[model samples]
Target: MGNLLGSWRFKEPSTVEECDSTWGSDSEDDEPAVEDDSGVSDSVSPERERAAGDSSPQLAEPRDSLPKMKRSFYAARDLYKYRHSYPNYRKSRQPNEYRNLCFYLNKIPLVPDGIYIEEILTKWRGDYDKLEHNHTYIQWLFPLREQGLNFYAHELTQDEIKEFQSTREAKRRFLAAYSIMLDFYGIKLLDKSGNVARASNWQERFQHLNESQHNYLRITRILKSLGELGYEAFKAPLVRLFLEESLCHNTLPNMQHSVLEYFVYTIRLPATRRQLLRYARQHYRPAHAFLWGPPPKRRGGGGAEGSVGAGSSGIRAPAPTPEPQRRAEESSPTASSGIIVSSHDAMMCQELGGEGLKSSAGLGSSMSRLEGALMMAGARGEMNDYSEIVPL
Candidate 1:
């Protein structure tokens, strides 16, 4: 015991004045762990080593050529070993550690405000104005497993996904929330068929889409949340409807860039992405190039011909696969089964696609007008400034 004490010269705990330079942002709770590990170093000068008659030291000593300055005691510790031991790391790494877990998973509220998942849906029942005006509740309604605008809210968990997929009641409420949001955007959710179309009140909603700048971002989040929560079949029809409104109806003019660039691409499932890309190509007018960015390069049939190719330029092209079903859930955590474009949409593409191009007789003038529209879209603040990767 005496030799153990003597071998390493342990110093007295330094005063706050002495530690002012060494101490950092580490919380008070962390001090106990550091002291318990007792990982502090006993760095000494060569003169002290000579005074103690010590010929060897375990750690490499500071080189004599370097200027002798006081080393930070905190710096001398093996920081990386306990780097993840911090409280935030602890909570984020094992989210379930807290007794208060996600309401979707554990039926408990993890955050302080503590609103029940069902209560929010109940409040917004058939009330489009409340749904339209309230922005904070959207993140709660679509709880993703990432940072969102509502910093106080907890993210959805894997267990939440697994649980949410199983619970009919939770899904019912979730579907209700989705329905209200769809109504707010002038789209109608056919709950029986699990499909959506432009709502009866679409004219007003369409006008709202024209005026509201932030709804596109919200739509991106809504698609990502739907993908995350396993409503695999629901994303595409809404996008296709928006696309049709832009292309055939000549309404929603500003949304063409968003629908093609962000909306279709945010669907994490590869098959869904391919289906939408193929559908877009079928009705793709040459004027679209000047509107949205250029189309994805057409490739040979080895991979799915419609496969969007990703490059260093930031286009997320999932590699083409001949067998669409090969992209199993395990291969892509967020991929799910769905058809974005409806059968009616396909028939419409067959009928009106040719007529629209025939109507667009002067290709040269159309491209020029579309080019002006593109510039005006940028001026209108609808450019693709936010290229998000909606991760699992």
Candidate 2:
């Protein structure tokens, strides 16, 4: 039968003694001793001799005399061997290791020509993806996508890019919010100590704090994180605090002007005003002892005490003094005190004119009869003139 695995022919082999000495036995001892032209033995070690013998044909003269191979096949072999030992080496290698391997491999001409073309293309695509992903991620995190892109493209230094790339989303959001807050407050985030803290993992760190504490920590963390992101941390906190206090209601009397300003600012929001009024109405009480104020009396009829009158000067006449006997008849301190109304309520009254008088009756019926009478007069069209009732 024909040879199945191609033409198989065995030729007579040359004797060991007749074989060319260049391809020597694969043994250290088989290496010939280095000799001068006269065949005198030299003191070179067997390893050195083997290297010298192997290199002789390719490179004339001693290896030490020539430039060391800028790169060596042996080094490449060692790398391949090392990489094989680790399971994950086939995946992405650590940056430094990959760089070294790439540098070494690039110097070797033994690889097929243009072999690196495909590798370079692959790497370029990966880098592009990485940059694109980073761009998209930053845009998702902040409305300042264009700004961030500019910063990364032209403003960011190499170190900054490294930091941004290494930073996680939580950290990035904290930084962005913190920077915006600082801009709001006009404060810097960094301190003289240089012990910058990052907001990246802040939520996890202070998750156990109470609501108030959590808010405080969150603001502070945002500031610190901004610092880590190379912004002014101090300013961010100050701005955030200002905004928070201005918009939020602070019951603390001793709170600073900055904090109060922030609270007031926040209160300006429609939602915030609604909440403030809702809360204030629930807890607020007037200092006056009267359960209800008297109905506003008519300008001319009976000229009852506590009656308000419209005047030419636009000022309303004050309530008349009660007769001594009548005062004695109803002298409860609660009855004597004027009705208390919130600024909001007073504004409503002024806006509604005479209709506001009816509102007073429904305010609370437990008020004194004297106060009720005043409220009824104001309700019954006698004091339709809103010019008399001062807006709170």
Candidate 3:
């Protein structure tokens, strides 16, 4: 009974034995394990194998190889370096940076283009010195002339006039300014002796240009100026140019209107007006009636003197038409003579009491009514009667 009890007694193993039991079994189970020659475990873990496989040796080389990428990494990263140092950089390269900047002494703000002379004059209030002193302000003159500011150009100083006459841009401006002054204001560029300056020169220049050149705008302005200043002198030239030149055909309505306006406003002579009407009737019959209100009536004897001085004479005598006989002649004359007299000869013969003579009272009554029509037409701003007086 004592031996049986001793054999059944349980005792714990030593630490070394316990450790060998646990580790030794696991090591034997693991296949192809490495042994450490230095007595330390040389077995690599799964994590260590993965890290060794991923790691690679790198060769040292320059980062930038192209000319464009020559900047260092530190310099590229420092972005604010340029912003702080640009002034110094510009100072070093001053020639290139400052080439475009220009400064002018006594410069004023430029006026807006197409400014009117009236507005400029009103602003300046006729103070010539202010404009004359400033070179920059004087530069505005050319643009002003382009906008048709002739009156202001006419007021140029002697220095300015000399500048204008000599400069290339001044040719047209000088002509336009002087012409406008003479036409509208009856003022000419005069000498100290009060004689017209360059009068013959202007005439010769304009007349020669009319024959040689075809600058339509300059020619038109010249013609208008001369017509307003001296109609009798320009009349023949204007008529010839209007009839012969291509300006009338190419610039249709504007040209026609300008020609008609000249005749309406400038020409005051009776014979001149008659000749204009006849020419217009022969050439442009469509606009003839609109331009010249009514044709002259058939005149009896002793009417030549009246016709000649009709423009000077304020009151015009109306010629009575024998419409009853004239209309009868169109169909067939019922008179025993069976012969037709021209309207003019008939009127003369009737006034002489040869035949078809109306009573003086009847003729006077007809004349009174005709005179009222003429007066009303003139008052209403309608086309003037062809035979009406043209006031000088």
Candidate 4:
């Protein structure tokens, strides 16, 4: 009896049994769990076991990471190129603002100011002093997709475009307003169409634009507005005209970089922009086989000109009295309907996002990257480029 008493020891509290009592009977929805190695009876299901796992933490085993595959440069480029997986789709419209734009287009006076669109286009016509000096009217005559320099004016919306395009009078009035500005720049909007030709008084008007500082900014606004408001047909031709006289003719002197950077880049439509670039690539006439020549230094403080610079600022200058292949009556080389910007020649938009497409040959800069993004905006088929075929 003494030997038996010496061998015996006090039983430790059974924690597993306590745990089973607390958790096991609570799983009313789950099936009963089979007994583990423990001798303690437990009715706890797997779900219940997981819920009460903090009491007896069961850690998961760590996972091994998969090895990354090696790739060739071209292979990687093709694989990771910008796919434009997302789109910029607008959800709402500003009704009051849209109504105001319509009213302005229709020549109806708006509210207390009683300002109609035509008042600015006609009353201010040929007054370069007023046109250049008074900044508020430009926003009204040629509005923008985004806010303009004038804060009081409303920026355009998609609804304005849809509403304006369906109306004939609005389109006609818009073109008329466009014509007035073109005339101011020494270019004439062709009768009954959105096209342009050099005005009869081209030299004087052209000289003012050539001399004035504000015209280029207005030109950018015009291009952006035309695109936003569905007069996209006007954009490519205008850009082409600028490129032809500036880049190809060298008539305008040191404007190669300015036109490439600001004027052509102002376009919102990607297809039109890429078409213009391809035209530039064709007409650039680089002095070296490798490097492009530096842009010429500007004179008269960035604006001064005379004698059509090299040719007419007209929408379609008679093309030096017309070639046998190209008619005198035929539209300018950058006409909207004629040019088909092929998908094969599509742009280096993906390269800008660093997805690594083969880079374009020349003029790489932050400006180029921004233009790439603008190109991507029109990549979707939602909008179409005004396809004026230029007889190459």
- Among these predicted structures, which one has the highest lDDT? 1
Q: Write the per-residue lDDT of candidate 4 for residues 1-392, one digit (tens) a residue.
A: 99996666534323212211111232212223532223212234554423321112211211111111111222112111111101232343666657546666554664335677767656867776766666666676666554555666655566776777787777777777787778778787765536666788776766666656346667766776776667656776677777776766655444554465455544443334445654564555321110111111225432121111111111111112224434422455555556443322222221121111112212212222211221111221121111111100
Which is the winner by TM-score between candidate 2 and candidate 4? 4
- Local distance difference test scores for all models: 0.48, 0.27, 0.29, 0.45
lDDT of 3 by residue, 1-392 (tens): 88986456323222212212111322323223443222112344565432322221210111121011011112111111111211122112232221101101112223433444333434643233443233332223222111122222222222333343355443444234334333221124343222232333444333433433222223333433333222234443344344322233432333443343232223323334344533443344222112232212235444422221111111222333468856767677465467666657644643332111113212111122211121222212212222221111
For residue 218, model 2's alpha carbon misses the true position, in angstroms, by 16
After superposing all C-alphas onto the true structure, candidate 4 shows an RMSD in angstroms of 32.8
Model 3 TM-score is 0.23
Q: Tens digit of lDDT per residue, candidate 2, span 1-392?
A: 56753454423223211111111221223223541122111234555423322222333333223221011122222222211221122233234432212221343211222233223323423242332222222222222111222232212223332445455643444343434333322233465422233244333322321222213322332332233344432332344333333333332212322221122222112222223322222222220111111223334433322221111111122223345644654565675575544435544433333112234322212222211121222322223211111000
Candidate 1's TM-score reads 0.49
**Candidate 1: tens digits of C-alpha lDDT, residues 1-392:** 99975465424334222222111333333233332211111233455423222122311232221111111223112111112121122224354542213454437653555667666656656576766666666676777666566676666656556766777776777777788788788888876555778888999889878767467767866876786677645777778788788766877887865676567655434344445554454444431122222223334422222212111111122232334454453357555454344334543442332112223222121112211121111212112121222221
Candidate 3 weakest lDDT stretch, 10 residues? 98-107
What is the model-wide C-alpha lDDT for candidate 3?
Answer: 0.29
The TM-score values for the models, in the order shown, are 0.49, 0.16, 0.23, 0.48
The reply for model 1, stretches above 4 Å from the true place, is 1-119, 282-392
Off by over 4 Å in 2: 1-253, 256-262, 280-392
The 10-residue segment with the lowest total lDDT in model 2: 383-392
TM-score of 2: 0.16
Q: What's the lDDT for candidate 2?
A: 0.27
